[model samples]
Target: MDIVLQQMHYCLTDDASNWLVIAISALLVVLWYERKRIKEAIKQDKTH
Candidate 1:
């Protein structure tokens, strides 16, 4: 029973880490997209 509890704890922790990584990755992607858009707007302003 003790071993089973330990195994369950480990599994839950692993899943939590996976979710955290995915959330961070999604945030990074959004930041990158926004950065690119801002750069393009700056370039357009410079042209005018």
Candidate 2:
């Protein structure tokens, strides 16, 4: 019983860390995409 509890705890923490990494990656991608859009907009304004 004790071993099972320990394993369960470890799995939960591991899953939590994976989720954190995924969330950070998603945020970075979103930021990068927004930056690209802003740069394009700036270039268009310069043309006008």
Candidate 3:
């Protein structure tokens, strides 16, 4: 029982890591948006 629980825990963590990587991969698709956001924030700070 304990071994099965341990295996399940590990599998869940592994799957979670994969999901996190996939989510982060989507950010790469919007590289321009991220750059634009950063540029705008910098411009705003300069104005302030």
Candidate 4:
């Protein structure tokens, strides 16, 4: 019983870490896309 509980705890920790990594990656993607859009807008403004 103790070993099973330990295993479960380990699995939970691993899943939590994986979720954290995924969230960070998604945030970075959004930031990168926003930055690109801002840059384009600036370029357009300069042209006008």
Candidate 5:
């Protein structure tokens, strides 16, 4: 019983870490896209 509980705890921790990594990756992608868009807008403003 103790071994089973330990295994379950390990699995939960692993899953949580995987989810955290995915969430951070998604956030970085969004930030990168937004930065690109802002730069384009600034370029257009300067042209006009």
Candidate 6:
């Protein structure tokens, strides 16, 4: 498992690392938006 992790670490060059960070940030943003939207929907449903 350690060897696999080391190989993956070496495979990501500088550009790949930047893209990975961007992709993770975008994913987190989308998840946050979805969670907020769902909470609002549930609140509205409870009111109705």
| Overall local distance difference test of candidate 5 | 1.00
Q: List all candidate RMSDs to the true structure.
A: 0.9, 0.6, 5.5, 0.5, 0.6, 7.3
lDDT of 6 by residue, 1-48 (tens): 999988887876766989999999999999999999999999999999
Residue by residue across 1-48, what tens digits does model 4's lDDT show? 999999999999999999999999999999999999999999999999
Question: TM-scores across all candidates?
Answer: 0.87, 0.93, 0.60, 0.95, 0.93, 0.75
Candidate 3 lDDT, tens digit per residue, 1-48? 999999999999999999999988887768878899999999999999
lDDT of 4 at 14: 100
At residue 34, give the lDDT of candidate 3.
88
Off by over 4 Å in 4: none
Query: What lDDT would each prediction earn against the true structure?
Result: 1.00, 1.00, 0.94, 1.00, 1.00, 0.93
Q: Which has the better lDDT: candidate 2, or candidate 3? A: 2
- Name the weakest run of 10 consecutive residues (lDDT summed) in model 2: 1-10
Task: lDDT for model 2, please.
Answer: 1.00
Arrange candidates, best TM-score first.
4, 5, 2, 1, 6, 3
How well is each residue in 1-48 modelled by candidate 1, as lDDT tens digits?
999999999999999999999999999999999999999999999999
Report how far off residue 27 is in candidate 2 (Å). Answer: 0.3
| Candidate 2 Cα errors over 4 Å, as ranges | none
Q: Per-residue CA lDDT of candidate 5, range 1-48, in tens?
A: 999999999999999999999999999999999999999999999999
Candidate 3 regions with alpha-carbon error over 4 angstroms: 32-48
Candidate 1 regions exceeding 4 Å error are none
Predict model 1's lDDT versus the native: 1.00
Residue 19 error, candidate 1, Å: 0.6
Clashing pairs in 5: none
